[model samples]
Target: MTDTIRQRAEAALAEVEQVSAVVLAEPTDANAIVPLKDADKPVGAEITKRMAEIDMSDTQSIVSFGSNAQAELQEISQSMLQGVRNKDVGPAGDSLRGIVSTIRGFSVSELDVRRKRSWWETLLGKAAPFAQFTARFETVQNQIDKITEDLLSHEHTLLKDIKSLDILYDKTLNFYDELALYIAAGEEKLSILDETDIPAAEAEVEKAPEGDQVMKAQELRDLRAARDDLERRVHDLKLTRQVTMQSLPSIRLVQENDKSLVTKINSTLVNTVPLWETQLAQAVTIQRSAEAASAVRDANDLTNELLTANAKNLRESNKVIREEMERGVFDIEAVKQANADLIGTIEESLAIADEGKARRAAAEEELKKMEAELRDTLAAAKSRRDGVGDNAGTAVPGA
Candidate 1:
């Protein structure tokens, strides 16, 4: 009986060592569980079956914890996407109002309303000629304002998306940390089982049954108890190892997800945001040029109308002067002053027209520069995409 018991204890110890060796073997891949070799499969299956029979709560708890974490990660990912969609940087209406105010204040006189008004005009509470100016430029201002609002909206969307990406990155890193710690704890437990618990149990078995029949029988019972404890520890360690192996695929999945999201966010920041900004700036320049041209056109039309009215009045007055000369009466100074005023108005209108032409030319050049920048940015982005290839990195199994 003693010999048989010793043989059985030795067999159990050997089995424990075999399972420990299999469990502790280095994995072939970082992102996946190592596939068992033909020789290892039977032992691996046996360990898995025994673990299931024992119903190891620690192993189940770890799996359950990982499952809950994965589900939460999914929820966070969805929330991040929804948050990007739902987040508002600010109301376009407020920005639109500000743009309109800016347009209202934009002037050749550097927006100084006081410079356009004299002390006498202030004392008389006379409003500056802003009403007529706005009336003439309202259509162009409205178009510019609309474009400005659109640009602001795009900026807001980009900010929200970037914020969402940041949140997702943080959650992914936290999940990775937790998985690493769990894997480490499981590995440690397996190590303790192999190095300490199994060895101690084997020693106890070897030391048992060295006395008389009665004492030997008692020692044998203690040895059996020790063997049972060792068996349970081995089972628990096997289950922990299995759980850790199973978790690798999920960990890899999250890691890949994180990598993909980071790549996408970087692409948006590098390519999309800058492209939109360039387009917005170009639009603003075009609108400004149009506004300037419209102001010039309005000024020219007003100048022509005043000139025509003045010429008609002068002709009527000269006809009256000729009739008065026939009756011996005339005022030549008034005629001279009217001619001077007309020349000054024509010169001012021509100066405004020249300024508008210069502004339009500058705006056109700026637009061409913006277009070149956009093309360069797009080409660079495409080149980067191509260099990265279809798979950004090694394809992780089960990811």
Candidate 2:
């Protein structure tokens, strides 16, 4: 094993050895109390057995744990590539994409109820404004309902994902622990092969070429190869363990994001939605009251203005009748100017109509020519593509 891996394994084993036996409770019987050294005997023996069980020459998977494991965790690393998202992706990509989509779905609409309300509705004292507001309010309410429904749907998905992550979190931790133990055991086995097995194998190979010398050489080669393979296997397990460590934090970040989403959704539903509804109700009530008051004032103003307008109309009518009687039927100059204007207008209109017809005809011919050119271009392109495909599929004659 490499120095780095050896150090890590040694440190891990040292930590394990540091854990001493603990007394669960005070013993009532004097005989029940055992000395610390005696209590540690079983634990030390188990650790020894564990270290002895690591067979360096056996070429099975590292995480096999002598078949205590079903799946080997040495292949659990796509980490050399990266995490799901890179730094360039803005604000935690797919992790929060669902919540982001739901939140960003919120937008504004041009619900100009007043513009849609007719002038006559306001001036002629009708309930058209109230009807418009009520209908628009219903549409707004429906939009709110849609927002809630969409959020609820996203929440359901979040809940399911969170539960799945909880299970994954546990499995990942267990795998990491198992991989660490495997690495420590593999490291110790490598040490033994180097100090004892390799020296012995080399010594055996150094003997004279007699009495199965070829066999001894091959056995020495195999032993060294096995040790090298063990080192590489231990290295891979270390990488797998690192990846599992990264996964632990990744899982936690997702869980925290899920929690934040729940809080935001609850705030929208419980606080913001209810507050908007309350304000909308109050504004609608106030607007209705103002419209009713305005209608009463408009009625009184209309009555006063009508009484004054009748007197003014009589005075204007007398003056108009006198003025019309003094005027001539038609001035000669006015009639000539009227005829000239009418003729000029008709001539201009006719000229424009003719010019439009000629231009339209020219445009139609040009469009037909363009269409033909386009069709020819497309057909030629298709012919070239077909020729290329045919040539590509053709094979050369060979011996």
Candidate 3:
């Protein structure tokens, strides 16, 4: 598909290169050559009447007498200039030049290549670069189509104007023919004045009476000045014809350009746009296939990793569960801690009992010592009192 467009594009460019130069047709109308168009029109009766009233004694009046022809020639020149202006191709040319490269850019953009996406993005679905490019490609395609439509419309206008330019080309040639007739007509008038009127007056001057001779000579001088002015007007009209000639080829060139633009625009619309769309579609299809394959491979790899991790976790969990199942209700470490705590309580109680017993034994021994001392003291006193009262006691016992 790309090759097809390339071939067509090369052909289109060749069409532009081979656009033949515009060959303008020369004037061939018998009426334009024989009977002058505007040149044959009679001058105002007012101007002709005023010419008689002007005194021959004034040289300025004589020289400026025949000026209607110059006025008409100037009018023709202005009309020709306006016609050229009306047929201008600048606007169309600028429109073509501005958008040609811009439209071409679309056909050769990054939309042609499908970018590779990273593996990690598979879960993010539609996050691939190719997916983004598909969206971008769609937007670009719409824009190109829009531009193509606009250019095709413009080419339609250009085609019509190219035909219109041909008509204008002919009209410009007609202006040239009209200007030629004017120059020729003015020269014919100048010829009669120079050959017939001036020679007759000069011969009459040699033979007329002295007073009438001076009057005839003044008339003769006025005739010669009028003739010279007419000739100058005719020369000026010839210059106007030159302007018409130059405008011919310029119009043809514009028409030629319009033709070339039409060809190129047609090629872009018919060939380039469709080819680009095909390529973009193909690129998107390829990328989608690649992404599907990558996503599947990526999903499989994830599944395997998850299974391996689950197996490792299952092994650890089973070992811990079996150890729990095989054990007694109380752990030995807790029992040992409780047993040590009980022994410390018992030993402390026994030490307290032993200390109390020792104190009681000491107390018993001290009590015995004290009691013996007291008894000894009392016996001694009693013995003394018995001896002293032995006599009195024997008497009291008798009483």
Candidate number with greatest TM-score: 2
Tens-place lDDT per residue, model 1, 224-298, is: 454445455445544654665555455445444434443433333334444544554564565566667767887
Which candidate leads in lDDT? 3
Go through the candidates in order and give each one's C-alpha lDDT. Answer: 0.50, 0.58, 0.62
Question: Please, what are the lDDT tens digits per residue for candidate 3 over residues 47-100?
Answer: 234335333355564444444434554565476557557765454455445445
Tell me which of candidates 2 and 3 scores higher on lDDT.
3
The C-alpha RMSD of each candidate to the native structure, in angstroms, is 38.9, 26.7, 22.4
- Decoy 3 TM-score against native: 0.50
Per-residue accuracy of model 2 over 1-399 as CA lDDT, tens digit each = 123433433443332222212112211233122222343565334335555655655656433443343143322333312433332323322323443353344222222223344676558765554565666676666666556555544544555555555555666666665555556666667777899998988888777467767888888887888778878877877777677677778877876676556555545554565666676678678767877877798799999999899889988998999999988899789999999999999999999999999999999999989967666655555567667434432332210
Candidate 3 ranges with C-alpha deviation above 4 Å = 1-24, 27-128, 201-219, 300-399
User: What are the per-model numbers of colliding residue pairs?
Assistant: 0, 0, 0
Clashing pairs in 1: none
Alpha-carbon TM-score of each model against the true structure: 0.28, 0.54, 0.50
* Candidate 2 residue 395 C-alpha distance from true site, Å: 99
Looking at model 2, residue 376 earns an lDDT score of 60
